[model samples]
Target chain A: MPNLYQEVIFWALFAITVFSALLVVGQRDMFRSALALIVTFLAIAGIFAQMNAEFLAVAQVLIYVGAVSVLVIFAVMFTKDMPHSTRSTNLQPVSIVVVGLLFIALSWAIFQSQWNEMPAELPVFVESTLVDSSSQLGTAIIRDYVMAFETVGVLLLAAVVGALALVRDK
Target chain B: MLERYLLLSVILFCIGLYGALSRRNIIAVLICTELMLNGVNVALVAFSRYSTPAFMRLTSVDASDSVKVLDGQAFAIFVVVVAAAEVALGLALVIALIRSRNTTDVTEINLMGN
Candidate 1:
């Protein structure tokens, strides 16, 4: 069983994440939606920490909050216009029904499934003082997942080039 | 605890789905997609923490005998990398769309659909 502080913090982060994610989807102002997205990302990072993924939590803050949200806010600024109350499509009702159904089915599956979980006493990487989690992650990337690592690097380079090409003046 | 995290993931994913399907603004669509990715990331990390075995450090005469598995977190890192690259390119495309069409509304920019 998790400690009391862990449960409290987890619930708090969960509420914040869900609320801000809703704001991101529902806000009328695009700028405010982007801001709410930032909040959602931050809260998710906190949840990552609760899951004992400190490295992922840091990367979440740096990549999602730092880079992605900043880029999105810049896009919002570039496309700013007169505020409109309506941002939803004519398909809003249909989308709501579909998403609601999806949510129900997923939650049902989650509750019904029997996952093969590790023993409760198994130490999470960050909690184990004997080994460095980040270093282990790095070694796995270089040694075990070197092909995937190189592929991701190439993918990023291609994305960068493609984006520049797309945005350059005609 | 696993169920709680999974439930949270589904909720966020569903909300993002609704937004992506219903939002008229293209940037809003992009933002919703990011939310979906984050939802997946949460599930990934939760499983990583709860489902996977603990880190085992084996010592042999050759140090290369040691084995470490952080597969879920590594996959999550790749997901983050892909998401970052995708968002960069996506925002660039949004900017270019704004430059050419002068509007960010997806409904108004349906030039390709017959």
Candidate 2:
């Protein structure tokens, strides 16, 4: 039942995301790795679009591909010494084993779990509402989740202050 | 559909985890963390889109509909906001590390007063 268009896009996004993530880990140059990270983020955003989460896709592009990628590039700019020290032991074999184990465990859980069809009286298929998520999201932030919303604002404020204090001359 | 999305999310998370753990550079680690967070966001949004109750879907016409739960989008927004803050603070720390040691290796900066 898979449409060719969706399948094509999904597989393309998946390939780019995984490949760029590998680039992020394997590239000797930190700047090139940072650029690869941007590709990964953008591909993930495309996946978000394929999922029909329009608002989230936009936010992913704006916040992640735009802001976070820029911040990471600046960090890479500051830390240019990573490429020089090509230590033989820079890679960890244990991490690969651990990640493989985690992937197996997660796949098992995903298959065994009944998340797609919960026992509760949930819809068989959630109607994709790509048109109204932004309005709905804005409303949720203001009405039901207002307290958490304010807390996030305060957290950002504190983060700014903390960053300044950390960088200040001692 | 849900399974496909979840599978991608899980794989993305594992890749990010490996990158964070195996890579020596702190910046690579940071990028990996961002990738992991994006994976989590994907899962959250997928759940939100796929898990709505039938009654909520039918009855929720207005933006103020309490029956409808846009919790996933809300959580994703919070994650994005917090991640921005985290990157800001994290880069500052990275800069400090660079200034102090002139290096970006995670193994070199031991603050244990050795």
Candidate 3:
């Protein structure tokens, strides 16, 4: 009962994810690689959308694609001579073979695992009811996971202060 | 369909890992790390959908009603926030290194004295 549009979107995202990943590794210019990483992030967001995690999809776009990618690009800009290097090369052949073997083993394990399907009793429109996901998440963080939430906040604050210190003139 | 998505995610992740481990340039390594993060995000959502009650019934597979989908989504959000923080810290370190060494190449930063 899968819809045609879902299939099309899935394939499109698959192509984009693979292509952008290739560009990320294959491109010589650091800036171009960053751009490809952005596209890869966006395509992953699309995949999140297809998985019905609407909130995550939007967050992925706003956070990773918008914020993190821009930060990396700016870092590239600040370190100007990085793009002039001619040393784009793959890892050693033995390592490549090891990685390939690891990938095959992992994929095989994934395929062999008997995954449980969705429960039948859950509501169909949970996405609609959960539209205020951020608020719900906030409540959970504050009530049950308050310590973890505060820790993350402090970590972000430390990161901002540290970044400023690093960039500031002595 | 799920298999295809999983395959793509795995490939992208491996490429990213290769780049992170092999590349000499810091920017290239960062880009690869981002790629690996995205791969994890994809897997999380995919598994979430797979475990959802509605999706299970759609595929006509009997699953326990106690399973919740929100956990995966919440974890993904946590990862995104952490990734943002990590990039901030990482870029700061990279900038500081560049300023001191006047270079960004990983191989050139051999100040540890072999």
Candidate 4:
């Protein structure tokens, strides 16, 4: 079981994540909403750290908070002059109902399911050096998941070329 | 503890859904989609920390006596990679839209209509 401090931190990060996500959705100013999105990503990274996924937490920071948020902010800046409002559309009522129903059904299923939970902490090794999760992840990617890894790289290259093609001068 | 995390994921997903469905700004819709993806990552990591598959439980073999599958974390990484690509293309598309339509309002840019 997680200690009291961990529990407190978890809840705090959770609250921050939810609040920032709401701001991202509700804020009228697009740039400020983008800023709030950075906060949400940061909080999610913190959550990942709490879950013992230190490698993923770092990746989340580097990729999401760093690259993705910057891209979004730039996009917002580029389109700053575009006439747009953040107000809800005519389907707002229907969307709210659908979202609410989705929440209820998902929560119910989560509660009803029986999960085979692992022990809270894995047994520590008696060896000289403790295994590093990041190193393990690197090995896993380059070894077992090499094919998928290369595919993602190719996909990223394709996306870059596609984006340039779409936006370049005609 | 796991349930709490899953609940948070559900809440985030729902909020994103509502925003994506109702908001007028195309950028906001993309941001909502990112929020939804983040929610999924939370659930994936939570499950990773909390559970191991039945096959890898007590019969694991290693120095640490743990099965280091890390499947959930791997999948989450892929999700992030795909999301980055998606956001890049999406932003590029947004830029293209702005260049052509001079607008970011999704409702106003109806190029295909009867």
Highest DockQ scorer = 4
lDDT of 3 by residue, A104-162 (tens): 98799777766665444435445432455555555555665667778888888988998
Candidate 4: pairs in clash: none
Where does model 2 exceed 4 Å of error?
Answer: A81-84, A88-91, A118-130, B52-69
lDDT of 1 by residue, A60-94 (tens): 99998999988998888877772333757989999
lDDT tens per residue, model 4, A1-170: 67899989999999999999999988989899999999999999999888777889999999999999999999888887776765778999999899988999999999998877765565443111114656666766777789999999999999999999999998
Best by lDDT: 4
Measured with C-alpha atoms, the lDDT of residue A135 in candidate 2 is: 74
Ten consecutive residues with minimal summed lDDT in candidate 3 chain A? Answer: A120-129
Worst 10 residues of 4 chain A by lDDT: A122-131
Task: Please list the residue runs of candidate 1 whose C-alpha ends up more than 4 Å from where it truly belongs after superposition.
Answer: A82-85, A123-131, B53-69
Residue lDDT tens for model 2, A59-141 = 88898888988888877776654444644234578888889999999999988887644334333222323456677678778
| Alpha-carbon runs more than 4 Å astray in model 3 | A82-84, A88-91, A119-144, B52-67
Docking class of predicted structure 3? acceptable
- lDDT comparison, 1 vs 2, better candidate: 1
lDDT of 4 by residue, B58-96 (tens): 555564323245667778999999999999999999989
Q: Give lDDT per model, in order.
A: 0.83, 0.78, 0.75, 0.84
The stretch of ten residues in a row with the least summed lDDT in candidate 1 chain B is B58-67
TM-score of chain B of each: 0.83, 0.84, 0.80, 0.87
